[model samples]
Target: MSMDPKILAFDVFGTVVDWHGSIAAEAKRLSLPVDPNEFAAAWRNGYKPAMAKVRSGTLPWTKIDDLHRMILDDILKTFNITSLSESQIHELNLVWHRLNPWLDTVEGLTKLKSKFTIVTLSNGNLGLLADMAKNAGLPWDLILSAEVFRHYKPDPETYLGVAEIFNVLPEQVMLVAAHKDDLLSANACGLQTAFIERPLEFGPNFSRQDLHREEFTTYHAKDLMDLAAQLNCK
Candidate 1:
């Protein structure tokens, strides 16, 4: 891309952590009657539409953690599950906070930290991201969230907000994400883009068929490790 972006803003959900596996594992640990994989998929399936309500201004600014709970409640009902107590539900909702990072995430981020300022630009709330980073050992310089900008991904404000935070031009910031729409939004706002392949983001059984680089992204990486290597991070 450009010589080097001053700030590397990351999309957190699937790019950094194995959300599907993490959620599924939690479900398995709880011995939920539903299939862990399908439960994970069902929970995630509600994410976009939930965010759409906020994007369309139908709902006021809501964090992804709250959004996840709303979806989870519905999913539990849909699956005919009524065994979970209030405490159990609350604990289950915090699964996002306890997500495990990909194997390369900590080391790769450690290397990249030597060269650039790294931050999270996720739909997750600041509190949620902060807790997750601490729990997962993610070395983020800052945590930028939808809660900070009052807008979600694909919104220009969210992308430009990162530039504002670091006091840099849009082109001097790079958004590394597993989703194309996210990268496209960042690119439209003049930020550099890196597409990280997270083939099993949805779940292990489901294969991701799309892995090609799009015109919008500045870099395409197999994972955080590959991106660190490409950026010449020690």
Candidate 2:
């Protein structure tokens, strides 16, 4: 990389927000008749495999919203949840739109935005990402998603597409994400990668086992604030 990246594309779900806590809280509010933590874990465990079906052409190119709904239905059955009406289920599946940002998210992004374009590169659909930004006061310069590229993480297209969209080389774009799978994929496509440590992404009591540094990324930090400092952002 000859210069600092012009854009920092982030993975939103666990990277910027507390999805597990949000979902678990929502579940508890609804009186789901199951342990909220276990419910959240079961729901999240189905995420990647669900995306894999779409990525491998086994399932149609379904949006994350629909995929989430599919997983929700399966888990509802897993937990024997039969009380929710159709409308309730529909609204409940939209909980991803209301996820809460991490403690330093808004401020850190505000700081990073002072230095470079800050955007999102999540698997979440555009509407979901937009609503999350508005709800959480996430200061995104622009939003990019798998919906835009019709591809998900681990696909070279999603990583390289960010550069093409901005008219820059891949190296001039950096992907800031908590997942190594995401960073490794971006790195393989020649984009710089920054790994953010979001240890409580799954839940508050859960200990993350994959916070160690790897050679694939250009930088690693404890959170977005740490990432901003490492990047020399105010």
Give a tens-digit lDDT track for model 1, residues 1-234.
476898999999999999999999999999999999999999999999999999999998888989999999999999888999999999999999999999989998888889999999999998899999999999999899988999888889999999998789999999999999899889999999999999989987998877898888899999999999999987
Residue clash pairs of candidate 1: none
- Give the least accurate 10-residue stretch of model 1, judged by summed lDDT: 1-10
Error in Å for residue 191 of model 2: 0.7
The lDDT, on a scale of 0 to 1, for candidate 1 is 0.93
- Which portions of model 1 show Cα errors greater than 4 Å? none
What's each prediction's TM-score? 0.98, 0.97
Best by TM-score: 1
Tens digit of per-residue lDDT, candidate 2, span 109-169:
9999999998999999999999999999999999999999999887899999999999999
- The alpha-carbon lDDT assigned to residue 151 of candidate 2 equals 94
Cα lDDT, all candidates: 0.93, 0.93
Q: How does candidate 2 score on lDDT? A: 0.93
Error (Å) of candidate 1 at residue 139 is: 0.6
After superposition on all CA atoms, how large is the RMSD of candidate 2?
1.1
